[model samples]
Target: MAYTAKDASTTLFRYLNITEQSIKVIENTNKRGFIYNTANGEKCVIFIYPISHKSDNSKNFFDTRDSGAYERGVSWNYALQNKLKYFCFAVHDQVEKYNDYVFSLECQEKIIEKVSGTLNGSRIGAGTQVVIPNDYIPNKQFERIFTKNGFFIAVIHRDNIIDYIDKYDNRPYLIDDSLIELDELETNDEDSSQSVALDDEYLSKLSRNRILFGAPGTGKSYKLNEDREKCFADGNYERVTFHPNYSYAQFVGTYKPKPKFRTDGTEYVSYEFVPGPFLRTWINAQNSIKSRTNKNYLLIVEEINRANVAAVFGDVFQLLDRKTDGTSEYEIATSEDMREYLIKECGFEADEIATIKIPSNMYIWATMNSADQGVLPMDSAFKRRWNFEYIGINQGSSKIKDSEITLKPYGTVKWNMLRIKINDGLTEAGVNEDKLIGPFFLSDKELKSLSIDEIFKSKLIMYLFEDVLKHRKGKIFKSDFNTFSKIIDAYNEGEEIFDFDVVSFLPDESNEESALGSVAEEPGKYSTENE
Candidate 1:
């Protein structure tokens, strides 16, 4: 049977199990090609040209002296100039010497050198080959070229053509198109949309590092917990609390004295470098990236503003400036002890010990309460690097159910409503917005389970006396019960019981003059006496 360009195009499409509608055949006097679009919208072409041979023997793979060889070299240069990812295959007829043909390493090297010249300094090697392997194709490896009889198949794509290669064994004989399984190809195409959506969501959540900030009890830390669980598994994440005493030695890693037991059972103190949460998370991220797991490692910092971030981060602060690709902009040098520890205990290569960088896959998430008055202020330069998300107070009924407290005469009051009332009272008293009550303050499940008196004594009274009244004394209440002790006595002994009316302390919307004043003031001061 005589072979033709049309025959080759038909065979290529049949091998790939692609429909005719998805591929167009291009037949020319010099070459035959197939044009198609990948699932990712990349245009691709597979071109095949006949190689001149001096004899019918397969041993004579190509006639290098012939004009066909020069034309083939020109074609390769054209492909390179056009920036197309091309794979070349040399075809031959069956020869008596070899039952099955395999391109020798020597021939592969020659082909690579010839293609490299055409590429103009571009690298080309054995990896560029598209072949049907008799044995198993290793996992993560791609096969691109195939050969049968006197036909050589060449594939070119705008993107990485290797990604399209199927990891399955090729039969010695031409298999029917119906036998080919296109399930992997279809699955990959379907996953493309999902992958894009995931990327968008990931970018929105955090481009580099992010800090979720809000008033206390606004659920900033809770948001982090939900996100951590959604994005990563337990082993892939680590959480740490930052406070006034937090230091670089405790965050990154440090040399500390550890007790070691001798052979005789007596203990001896030895100085050794210990890895901290940040370092451990970084190491795990590096390993995951090296293994090509496509997973992210998370580091959660609670109460980030509580610590002197500059002092705690030290040289590691430089790592916060990330490149568009998400890698650290600078590699900070590690301490000698850290270097030694990384190489000896962490399995880092010797050459990698000089400097350390936070990997792109290692994400840092932090939570900060805006209500924290004693925290070390973060500078503009430091604050500008991180993405900030504000968690607002949630007034949902479900959330309110977590802390519904019942009182005499008042019946049951939802924490959400109480929060709104208290915030309104604070606003009327001219207190700062940051000092306003957040719904989370009274939403604890344990607090919700408490009796009315217990709830008032344990949470509400403490919040009023310690947080609110401590800051805005007599300005928030009437002169008779201006102090917390007076208010507590009124509620406990039921003396001057009218002062214990919590609702009376909230602003009244019906009276315009008293709208900006708390109901705790003398009745006739802001509003007219009852008619």
Candidate 2:
């Protein structure tokens, strides 16, 4: 059962051993609230607001409505004037209980948006009300209590008034005295709760699950690496590449044989559970939370689609549906072996070891290229959980704009320019976008290779021949040089290799630099070494 606003205040006051100083009412404004103080001299004002009928179990929130509205009226003005702390408790409706539990967050002093209504030429709610921002709520579940008939009681441990709220307030607050002292050396003990409000300016922004996909050499991996450094300042990250044979046991965890040493310095073989990247990342995230570091932990998968993604993720895939806070909306049970390992080696509490979840601070990002073959397909259900961002073929082309590629007889042209021309021709020939050449296809270092002809044939021409135009060779290569060997021979002998005019490959026909007039190396900004 759920308790009403008046009943909640009465019961909460008793639980906290609060001495009520009566409801302070301004007869003219109809402004009213109960003022109370704890034994340790923490003064606070409580405003009772009913839970909105439209609210659901998905989230616990409330609206100030007519209760807090005042002409030129505003939030916390009374508490501010009295120099008292402020708290608002939102009680959930009885009909929406789950497992005999009612869910409602215990947050304070948050105003996200305004409810526009007028009363005697004054804005309702004085333009601000107490409400938690969906994104700022912590991953921990809300506080709940049971009620029967009209009696209101708290099932929580008996403690001081401030300690009582800290137990169930899912909304983050500044709790440590050292941190509070660092911000303000002379924090008033009577109004200390005033400092617990969320910082409206500082937002913990992090995307939990994202997949960057595009053609080869599009800088997907490079971009992921760049973001990792910027996001994880403490360098908490684990990187792994997915291949055809990658499995859930290897991705998450599994039992493996281990060698143990006895007192006599003799080694003996034993079997035990071994954690993989997934478990290692989870443990780091849990430790970060326990320490209140508030830092992000990242898990980077180099080629997500290369392996059977659904099979590799297995049941853990369900954790991808993140809430506004970047945490999994649901938790999944872990294998018995995994539970024991997490609790023993990772310092996870026994109560929480049975289940696993992607915490609000743990992020999983991956890169995939749809153009590659021998890779498994991803189902719609699996794909929908990730935010698919396409890394365009020319996404960061400007960075490597100075690199040059040599033409058969037309001198040299910018590597990016030649790539653009080839991409245009390939697209015109009905080739897929994923099969087109990217700016980073040939690194500036590769362009300066002594065996430029061989490098070009193996890197670019072979792709165009073997895969891009496997069915139509003459579409890109010249009709006379139809076979892969013919194109290579013509390219090596300084003959036109493309079906199109050789001059078309050069940006300026006037550039008469010899094939050996290589472009000087430029600082590399993208990864093309393994493209």
Candidate 3:
């Protein structure tokens, strides 16, 4: 048996010693535990109070007003309701006798016996005991006679409310205050949950060696730039755009002449050394990690294949290799050496000799456009250093309310699968590999704002698919003007649009018998019959 708001009046009469001519479970539109004047729909919430102040240590019951009922303060009553339905209860301390005499009555004990059987039991670490059940059924299990004022609370599962009570009680345990606080605060203010907390574990899990590879015009650069700003704002990232003109000196460091005056009143100059962005970023990441043990840093190398990988990386690449991957390090000559040595080895100016070493904290992220005519494939050695993720123009990828979109895969995973489908479809049509867009190019924020028709009118879809189609064997996809139109039509009227079956993942609904026929009618789809 499971306890519900319907049992509220009977339970209160038997346990709390409150008597009223009539009582009704009031369900409200708000998401909080509110007392109102109606009961209908699953959207309503019901609030439960301690049965009797004398039976539990919780002081709420003892604070009854002149009307002889427990009085919830202003905050509890006036707070905005914005959370899922929840049941609240307070337990009494056995040692306190202030109100115990009333609960000792035989009639009260009989009610306790009936409800105790459905309670769940658990030991919370110390000698403390807790009992939660689907329904308060006497003789089945022990009931929670006491509540730990502010220390212990349970968020019961709607369905498992019975099993939880039978198994967990009088067990030692620790409770999570933050979890409960988040729920209560949402109920208090009706605010949606924001970004997950920025903690050490999350930072440590960041993809340090990511490569955002995509076709041209798919918005890879935009997303990369956005993430770069976020990482930099946290003071843990450095950005450098790569090009054919970029040299080792520009990336690492170089020595130059500075004007000076000679002792003999003759004009003279002296050589001075200067550091570049790469070295600066390496040093900064190391210093940041030293101060904040769990922090991570990012270095964005735009158009990574534009420059010679070996010439640019020189010696630092090996030291930056992921430790988990077991790659070997390389030894190389430094920018600084005796002028004579530099002259003999690489024919550099004598003033350029000085030593600089790469730090270990630096991690590299790069972007490569697969569709650029001038772009050359990265060398095998350089390619092994990065982890590539393809970005594509996808509506789901750029939608903000993707989780609520009601798809088979639900959220981001839906976008990933769709990207795979596009690639597979294009492959079947004999499209070349070069034209495939990387899925990561688009963000969720960009998708939901535009309708399918609006997106198609922009010809962005044709621009995206054309590159891959050009490399294919047939002229069937060659007409850019028509290709865009067909692509748009498919997106708008496709039958498989809702292929990701999300409803199947939903939990069983309560009251299975009433919904049995409807659930059985669609065994493969959303079913409530077994609830």
Candidate 4:
């Protein structure tokens, strides 16, 4: 049976010889273990079964064949992997019976001191036993040292666990601090307050070739740029926007004819293979990996869904799968023209020029808006190979510092309040949340400098006409205007004529009227807009 926090606390209190009432259980969950608050306000967690290297059956302690044993092993491994401070206990016999166990603080201390050295040794394994000190006795009846066979329990202080979780909360696995080797500190960087830790934790979980998908205005493209800046240097990254005209010839490489001028001013045409963004980025990454530069290369594809992905990738799709060592899973045959170009211009070996492979250090990241129309649909086979992350609409206020704006007649308003009102209006009009405006729609500088009329005319008006109206027809505006052009004409006439305030544009409560002056009850149409 799975043990609860109460069960662990009861067992812990009995073994530690502490009064149960003196401690309060703060949190007890399978992932976090049992956190208990002591009388003095200090917190700690108890591990029901902790595996050690010296104990018998240590090798099979974590074996999945035994469900009960496997669970205990996982819990113990999590604590040790995260470098949490804990106490361990080994029950001698009758593992199922809890009443026979007795709490001894002296015994616990001696065991910890002995096991500390073993943890630093090379042969450490699950269930490994510690060499108890000679002064410690297992029982009064027996003078010789006794080894336990039941199970191990570990106690970890809460502070250490909290810190570890805070730093790596997004990570899929607990970070093993023991395996980390620190590098020498740089002398010139002594005054640097910035953390040297790499921001590749999210990338580690993602496939080498991945895409970010979300509703329009969700900041998908913005996040890709952010990642490029954070994880890669200037020379290490390249970017391209995909469109309906994008093809394999444009994405990869193709033979193109160029005019060659002669001395007599007569022009002659020469055909040469022109390399595209993918091939160029791949070759650069391959060179970096071969030279052991330890640098990453990233290729960012914006509006990836706008083009036919399968057609653009062609035979190169096979190169996306990476081996365990980060090299391409397969080397695909290249076209004769590409082979010639690779050998002559790219400096590839004669034998290697026949095939091409994506380097492991090369990463391909794309962004797609779920609301886009006219995009070529990707099949399951192609999408399953790439990891996808969804960027949701910003639920909080804009990150812009000291953001506040004042409308001539509406008085001063916070940017967050404006966003809330706009979003509320959009929602009331039956517009999907994904199509709602995002925080980055207007920048900090624009909000501070531009007048309210200019801001509304430039940003919100354009959004309504080009985006909301184009998709939802005449549903979002007041009933007086039947078309987007009519609304624009009305707005141009005078600011006072039409209330640009978000609340005024909301659907009428009594009739659920459309902006076109019709009693429309249908939900607003949805559409994707390129960022």
Candidate 5:
């Protein structure tokens, strides 16, 4: 609640605390603002302009006829750690938009020059300084941005010092830090600068070694995919899944046989070092850095715990501790094979790839379900290097409510309804939440299938019969559906699997068809991993 806090009115008066008497927009003024003391040893003034999206317009952004008075509200988007932070204004659902008119030539140009790479935003036509997708804005509450918790506007910041023009009006600006209540904590400008530097969003953006872990089907993978598409803008990324046999050599790099023909036409086998996902991504990040390209690179590891993670990461484990700039805190020396490969093939300096270090723009994210059958436990030392995000069972229920699950014999039930019933039963029976089904336990196509297909049974019913409901089967299914084969057969053969009259909870046909009409399922695109 920076706006509500003492000495933070440039934003509050400009957008939130609006009244004709307090923050009136001058008829002829393009923008106006006052100065306030920040902890950075100087004054900070925010210049903002009022704008809102017009729903009726399709092609053009702002309506041009100028006679009408516009009523603007704001979406008070804040990080979980820092409450009541920044609010963005944009016509689109994802990226916030601001025209160049609101910013100074320096703020407009320098914002793109100095901050575009570090900030997850793009500028257009040099017209807007920043265009950030709200979700990618770390520490932000994702759902509230779209709901218009309030209307939005644009803001800019610059330093202010006492430079008077004349005896009465020598300074460029008209406001003072004392014009607003000076928060005791913000009395010094340097303290405010340090506070801004340690903001949650800033820290999270720099160091992104995060793991989305939860029970099967809880949308851990779904959430990660979201981060893939939105947070990192779906470019300069690599995806790898880890399993029991997945090893460090495969993850980082190893030499493999390459068949080649000599000039004499004799075929020969050459052992060539092939860089795996990790090294390949690092190489790309290094190239991007060398070229000074403002691109973010990602390494998505699905089912991280499915493999013996320690063995898979091997010596690279130490490289997980990221510095504030997101580079590996420490570098691990590369194997000889890797060093030779780096110099000859990847254009790396002998000194550079001799040791492997993760780059700042490069990120490693993973999905884990400890309840999975073959999952290997992570040591505390390894676990401490990553931030864990637990996907709640209902984390994304709203997206799939229209999905219908039809038991050939029991009839069609809303996917969410049946999922809730199953989860509730498991909970009441004392089954751990981690052993329960998640919102994305079944894909849309799987949910719509009348019979339990191989994909469906293996992904879901087997999970329920073998793990989640192994000891708690009586809560949802018949006591004698004891074995995986038995329950799956019952499910596929039109026999009653659930003890309850689930058909009684079937969603209305009209609602189902109207809502999910012809919505084609793009397998693995939206919901791939069952983590």
Candidate 6:
């Protein structure tokens, strides 16, 4: 049983000892401050906000507010150390007018328990609050704390929670669920600083190729976008979208004609070189080169396979193969050189060509839809040059659940199981290897906006097992198409399946072939190999 919003809300209200009506307006100042209701002898405060913003609102306990004259004399320290059975607050606003204020000293022990319960029942938010430290020292025990709603509020030190509210009114403007802290928060600034501390020698360990793979909807693109921004050294990164027609000229550079109109009303043809995204990223990385540190450039190639990789990428592909001396051997005009070249060679002025680049400090990240036919027949030469990671369809769990924009009822485990089951069913029917659903099929945008049940069937047919689509509809025909259709149709025709719980499928490492191909239940796996 995992924690839920309702459970958190109920526990918080219980801690406050208040009815639903007692909560005034829920504040989301993003600052880390605990709203402890000393009204009860319990060392607990009912978080006035509901589950809607609970995760966002409660982060770290940094400092306390200016409870002003109203907060004075209320000893939180006294409540923690001694077996003080009673704690009280003089509220500027009367909370008792709405609800009965029946509190007993016996409730003191229960207050901490209730607060613990609220904290324990939910893990969706940011900060993980452990026991409240008394005599909390800032530099020693506590650094700074933020509210759940992402407000950087206070610095906690022994006996005092100091306020340091900023422009956000202590609110976190942007929340990235995907960038969850895998490890515990570091107290030391040196270890936890945002700056990439590694030098050239350290960069060698990270030089090996990295691949992002999973079925569709697993957030490959989303993660790539995040890394795109982070991978650059000095805010100099480039991104390129690959399509079927992307040419070699696009990746490198090509001479093209542009119309130039003079003030004298005479129009003439001007030849200029245009640099593409990959070229631009490579160029930017070189421009920001710093001494001592090996400068790194990021070139993100989205849908890498849509274009004929070999045809469009040609000599660059050869260049990528030999990671030796990555700078271009030929002396060519850069974007700056292109401007100079056009003015000198073709008689055009400086303010014409957009941007240019040299190949040094360039790194490439190419994304591809594994399910697309155009991308399926990737040449071996192309494949050997880069690391490959498969993004499968069932990989939807993490992206769906962690996002604040959408609250997926289906959790990661559940979603993965569903994908496994679907894949198994499709493989049993002999669907083509390239036809299986990947992340491209399911739409996060669609799922976020529409309910799963509404678009479930169509999504299954259209995106989930798209490989099945061409096989059933086209020639070179193979497999029991109706069998796959029946499984999908049956799932759609059911109220029970909609009520399905993912926990039903326990983790199975043995039958994990469902990740790539579904192992047949027969004597051996069906030989889908065309040979």
lDDT of each: 0.52, 0.58, 0.39, 0.51, 0.52, 0.39
TM-score of 2: 0.58
What are the TM-scores, per candidate, against the unseen true structure?
Answer: 0.56, 0.58, 0.38, 0.54, 0.55, 0.44
| TM-score for predicted model 5 compared with the true structure | 0.55
* Residue-by-residue lDDT tens digits, candidate 3, 187-264: 111111111223435434445566776555455566666655444333345567877777877777666565555546
Q: Rank by TM-score, descending?
A: 2, 1, 5, 4, 6, 3
* Candidate 5, position 31, lDDT: 31
TM-score of 1: 0.56
- Scored by TM-score, the top model is 2
- Count clashing pairs, candidate 3: 66
Kindly give the stretch of ten consecutive residues in candidate 4 with the minimal lDDT sum. 519-528
lDDT of 5 by residue, 1-531 (tens): 111111222333432334335433322222333232333334333333233233332222211112111111111101111221122222222223332112211111111222222111122111222322222222211111111111111122111111110111111112233332212112223222332232344335433787887777778777677656554532346678888889888998787776656657799987777767788778766766764443567889999988888888889998988877778999999899989866654445687776778888778888888777767888888888887766665666668866766556566567776777676668788888778777788877676665545665677666777777756777778887877778878877888777677667434545543332332222222232212
How much does each candidate deviate from the true structure in C-alpha RMSD?
A: 21.1, 21.4, 25.5, 23.5, 18.4, 20.7
Residue-wise C-alpha lDDT for candidate 4, range 263-315, written one tens digit per residue: 57799987767777798777666655543444577889998889989999999
For residues 53-82, could you state the per-residue lDDT of candidate 6 as single tens digits?
122323212112221111111222222333
Task: Give candidate 6's whole-model lDDT.
Answer: 0.39
Would you list the clashing residue pairs of candidate 2? 69-125, 73-126
- What is the per-residue lDDT of model 2 for residues 1-531, given as tens digits with 9 covering 90 to 100? 344555544545555555445445432232335555534556565554444443443433344434444411232445544555555544432433321222232222211112223222233233323333322222222222211110111212223234544332222222343432112223222222322332323324334677887778877788788767555532356788999999999999888776656657799987877667787677767766865645467889999999999899999989988887778988999888888776554435678867878888788989998889888999988887877766676767767767766656446667766676677678788998787776677766788777666688898888889878987777777878768888888777888777676555445524422321232223232223112
In angstroms, give how far residue 529 of model 4 lies from its true place: 25
lDDT of 4 at 206: 53
- Number of clashes recorded per candidate: 3, 2, 66, 15, 19, 40
Model 2: ten consecutive residues of lowest lDDT: 146-155
Most accurate candidate by lDDT: 2
lDDT of 1 at 30: 44
Model 1: lDDT equals 0.52
